[model samples]
Target: MTTNAELAARFEEFADLLEADDVEYKPRAYRRAAENILAHPSPIADQLEAGNEEAVENIDGVGDAISSKIVEYVETGEIEELEELREDLPVDMAALTRVEGVGPKTVGSLYRELEIQDLDDLEAAAEAGEIQAVKGFGPKTEQNILENVEFARTIGQRQLLGEARPLADDVLEYLESVDAITETEVAGSIRRWRETIGDVDALAAADSGADAIEAFLEWESIDDEIESGPEKASVRVGDVRVDLRVVVPEEFGSALQYFTGSKDHNVRLRNYAIERDMKLNEYGAFDVSDVDDPDAGQRVGERVAGETEAEMYEALGLPWIPPELREDRGEIDAAAAGELPDLITQGDIRGDLHTHTEWSDGNNTIEEMVEAAAERGYDYYAIADHAEGPGVVGGMGLSDTEILEQVEAIREVDAAADIEVLAGIEANIDADGEIGLGDEVIDALDVIVASPHSALDQDSAAAADRLVRAIENPAVDVIGHPSGRLLNEREGLAIDASALGAAAAEHDTALEVNSNLRRLDLWGSAVQAALEEGAIIAINTDAHQPATLEYVRWGVHTARRGWAEPADVINAWDLEELRNFLH
Candidate 1:
């Protein structure tokens, strides 16, 4: 009943939990198996149902033990081996490890030494002076655990992109302002434009390591210092930890490429490099002519490093892949064939399709929003604030009458404004997957992006049905943030994306790759699935404010990761074609 990807994800979660418990090589084995399972096209369950359990052995990196476990899981809907492992060290292991300074080994040690089973137990132990009594843990370590426990409880798991982006920018600006810093760029999930962030990673290419490290520690924006070292430094800015790594200029680009990764993407790229007879590392890639020779490529006769990203890619016979397209979702082949998607660039966006003014929770007025769009060289802008419905409460949504009044106001603004103004509404997708706006109201709008804001708890089957029904609505021009996810904060609706994509194609509805960094809802995997289903994506910035309009960069990045080319994006079409699609 489960898909290969789901099986892999479950196994990966178990592996992460096991890793946090310091369970040793078995954790690595599980993680490796998870990786192989994710890429396997055939459903392991289906294969098992068809009585081909040995098919698991065909998966690379899945050895006998893992294959047996998969057979057990597929047969009985459970893995006895995993259950036994959980029983041995049964605790809130995942939660315990989620703290800032806590990892698997630390969690294991604390459990063994202090008998701390959960967050509350660990907190009690930390307060009762039991933790500092452990050999490796000292006064500082105890303080860190206690401080982080409070933070962990207050902040939950990950920070939203809206909160994390500004912090990364602030840190980068501060680092750049310092005299010791030569150059700096944000790397990690933030740079990759992942919808959520666990930590903000920054890599600085500096001449003096000591000076850069010192400058980083003294940054006023840093609320608390976590760790400071020669190559790397970590500090807690509010709830988020900002990590900075200093690299020599020679390997800066390579380091940037390595550090800016979705771990799976990096693994595939690494394998690709190895297959090409090269080796990639934090330092620039090496020829690795002789694997037995540790210093073979760095020897006197060989070139040791790539000074730029292009050279690094060239070493592997790959054209330089963009950071956003580094998800390995098909970009490798696209890059190899020189058919990389010409994704929508920021300059190509002539106007914002959906935005709010003071009429909603927006920070600016409609006129101000338009002026900002004009500043970005936009020829037209649409004011598409929320319409009253299931998700909109506390005066956040406009009533039907108010929506009509706003349309007239938009017409008035259009007459006086230099750029054309269109009236639009972010209509609500009701409980039964129908837009609340009637045909008359829908006809009055230039465009309507119907979105599911509530009832996100619908099961996968029901969610798919709901979305399919909504996509069939003739008034729906775009399905906003198709999944409704807010990164790590919210899982959003569970729908069969491939099915949804096919339905959208049939209905001629554009799926919005919402530019909000927190809600890059159509994830890279979903985007790839959608494109394969021939679904058109509109890379729109559901801009609530002018400053936030720049989030299109994040949307573009997400689309590129999905291997989407300009042709795949409805917004990438010319204005005439776009208008025709809207109508």
Candidate 2:
């Protein structure tokens, strides 16, 4: 039983292997096919298994060859060509690529030059100063490899939310068809929307727990059954492990509340309940204010609440806290005081202020990208492609003349386009905290997103000052990917969020929580800090293609974790108000 995710992973591995082998054009093709397969509404392998090869091939990026491979893998459990590729390279592709500056080509080069097959081999060579001696390699490259080896070594302990979440959605969709289950919801850190998750946790309410577990175990996507009981089971799905728990319909609310915890929040909540002579547990809330004997059992008191999550919270005289805010970060007190901010939702974002096009390094044309935004029902869209500066390598950033030209093209599109269009530029902030854009270019653009592409290794103090300087510039409207961090990939930079947020507020500059899965910069705590300082947040995807516009979901969740409200997000405003704020 092949799952969409498992099939997608196979192609991703194929893409990497081909890239490592320096096969031209085919790598990108395979990667695109993989992305499409992963995003497909149903399982391609299932279609293939059912003798629907045409249906599998009809997928956007899947072609004859790729579909044939899908058919081969589905029928026989292996793609012979891929196994051969593995034998040829014989390197740990995933682990090696985890190192900061290393990619498939570099892995190929290292493997060919120094026989480095894995992180251990790479580490040993770097430590022994063997990498520096290889042709086309230098001491700096060797040192960088050494520095990132340990981080690379710890590659697969957690799964990316972007990857794990879709699989969770698939699981939920499958369980919805179970007749025995009355209610179903995800639990644990996944429900809280952590950037990285240890495993996927799902909860179900059912009259018969045995029936629910039986249905779960029969899931076609499950690769291995780790364990199972009458009401609970754990299974492996691709690289992620999923744990499912089923409880009686009556106890579902309490069980969900207890499981969807940050431990600290639950402890704090339990203490608060104890102070009121109430006992809280997964069973239900109990009023134990009066008991003649102290030796009574756990359920010895009157059950006051637990039928639903809201009721559970009401029993303790508190509002229902959003899962993202259940980190025990003053949310309990905020709920009690009736002062919890209404967090921003995905629908609140009206436009994308920071995005890319073919004018720079983006994959799509301006017209294609604009059409995608219009389809998403956005009121406005800004084409803020790159402006030439440091760290924007291989002539990826546009020149001043080209930017002005793109501005006119954008205006032309705006004339007949369904949405308001703004000509913008993502200008680079150099090490000295200066924007390299000329006055003419700045005046011509409708918006400016100044970002630090270089000097991402700056310490906290330097990073804070550098960003603050950029924020204070009157021409700058936003600071993009403030910390420059790439989750599970690169450390990027260290900045003082308090200092950054304060300066951004004073100067009316918005700080970006880049929606790209890898870099959710200005993450939860940092976004919270910035919000506390009265700074605006822009959850931009920084999308290079139309499909990536969906990254806004990740940004929205990250913002909610930080307690961001619609009022605190500039793009969440109407066009008129957004213009006022930009101005």
Candidate 3:
């Protein structure tokens, strides 16, 4: 069966092939269709199979042409046009594009000039000094490609949390619907809410393991069954691998603790148990100092805790730790000292400061965005559209005149809205650390999110200085996506976090944790450092659409991982408190 992920991949490949062939508008259309397809809540195959082509076409950015292709692929398991395009280019698009500086155009150029068909072919040509012979290819570009290709090869693939979590939720809901499964939960790095997951681990408490395993295998979402046993099963849901383990209800707690681990955390817990003459395992926690064979049975000697995860932790003489704090980064000690922080929660956030509208590249209009924020019960929302400057693509940025016009539009929206809508601009910070917007324009706005959009290759000292200067700007409320890094794609700016954090704290400027999955900037460790240095954090979704407002949870969890309290985040404050900080 074709899943949304599979269809999205094919569409992306189609886009890459079209771009390689120098096809103009269609490539962008294909790419947008791919993104919308991935973000679609339900499986695309189901819609196609139901013969609802109109519903499929209704997907944002998907036109009749793309919808027809999706239906064809669903019915025939292939798209003939994509096949023909592949036959024409015939190079490994995914592998070649993984190289840092190489893009589809470069791939097309290399294929035509040197007949390079794969990474190996490209590497051999580079090694032989033949790549520089191509018209636009220089020796430095070839050398950089050779160096980056190896790193790309070594880095294994991991699904982003944004993608993996939905699949995990589906699995959990499926298991809960079964009569045999009493309790079910997802484990592994997903439970820890890591940015990426290798494979999903699910656990179930059942009266009979065989019954639970059978129900799991029968789940409709399973595309392929990899393996199955009396107590466990592994299946492929779309492109993701899910492993299910069933244990007797009595042992659910110990089993959950064992599976939901950071390896380091479990190791520390085991050592701590040993000091108390107890044994810890997946079956249950046991007092084994007097037992002849501690491993004699699943529940050896006297069982202390196994029914619930809280019980399992209580047996270890510690309070129940939040899953996000299970990283073994002083969390154990903090729990022991009864000093665990009251971490920030989703409900604590009162507003979103950095958002976009159709005035920039966002899909929704200013009124639509404001209405969405009001619906979400936010006290205030800021319309921080792109200001004319670096990294603004396709003339998406607003000029000074346009910014003034937008301000009036924002005011009109705010007048009818239940929530406060602040007129703001996402100004670009130039390489010299000056904001692209004029001082008058900056001061005219209720908020300013100054971000480093270009010159990301600066050295550590320069990057730190650049950010410090932005923080020092009296009108700037937040330094957005401090490094501008995109997960698994770009290693954006390299700044001295301690220096940046101190400067931000001193200047009363908040550092932003842009919650877009691709750019979860001011990630856990950076958030921790900044918070420790008295810097205020703002967990903004950097949401471009209403659907993306849900991404704020990702930032909240990431902040918890960094030990940020509600008070540490500016968005968590009340309207008056937020206003005080902004001023």
TM-score to true structure, per model = 0.69, 0.93, 0.94
lDDT of 1 by residue, 425-515 (tens): 9988876898788666777889888888888767788888888888998888888887776553345788687998999999999888887
lDDT of each: 0.76, 0.87, 0.86
Top model number, lDDT: 2
> 180, model 2: CA deviation in Å?
1.2
Candidate 3, lDDT over the whole model = 0.86
Model 2 worst lDDT window (10 residues): 291-300
Query: What would the per-residue lDDT of candidate 3 be over residues 1-583, giving only the tens digit for each residue?
Result: 5677688889999999999989898987898788778777787788777877777978878888898899889889799999999999999897788676778889999999899988899889989999888999888888877777775564337777877787888889899999999999999999988887899999999999999999889988797999999899999987899999999999998899999997999998888887887888898888888988876776777888888989888997899988888877888889889999899999999999999987888878998888888889999999999998887756689998899899988989889999998999999988889887876677678999999888876778888888888898888999999997767556688876677889999999999988887788888878878877889899998877777788887888888888889989999999888888884
Colliding residue pairs in candidate 3: none
- Candidate closer to the true structure by TM-score (higher is better), 1 or 3: 3
lDDT of 2 by residue, 1-583 (tens): 5766678878988999998888988987788777667656666766776777788867767778998898888888889999999898999888888898888888898998888999899999999999889888899988998998898777557777877898898889989999889999999998999898999999999999999999999988898999999989999987789999998888888888999998999999999998888888887888888966423776758888876878789998999999999999999999999999899999999999999987987767888889999999999999999999998844689989998999999999999899999999999988778988889998898899999998877777788778888998999999999877777767887888888999999999999999887788879989999889888889899987777888899999999999999999999999999888884
Candidate 2 vs candidate 3, lDDT winner: 2
Off by over 4 Å in 3: 48-52, 154-156, 291-300
**Local error of candidate 3 at 369, Å?**
1.7
What is candidate 2's CA lDDT for residue 354? 95
Preferred candidate (lDDT higher): 1 or 2: 2
What RMSD does each model have against the real structure? 19.7, 2.5, 2.2
| RMSD from true fold, candidate 1 | 19.7
Candidate achieving the largest TM-score: 3
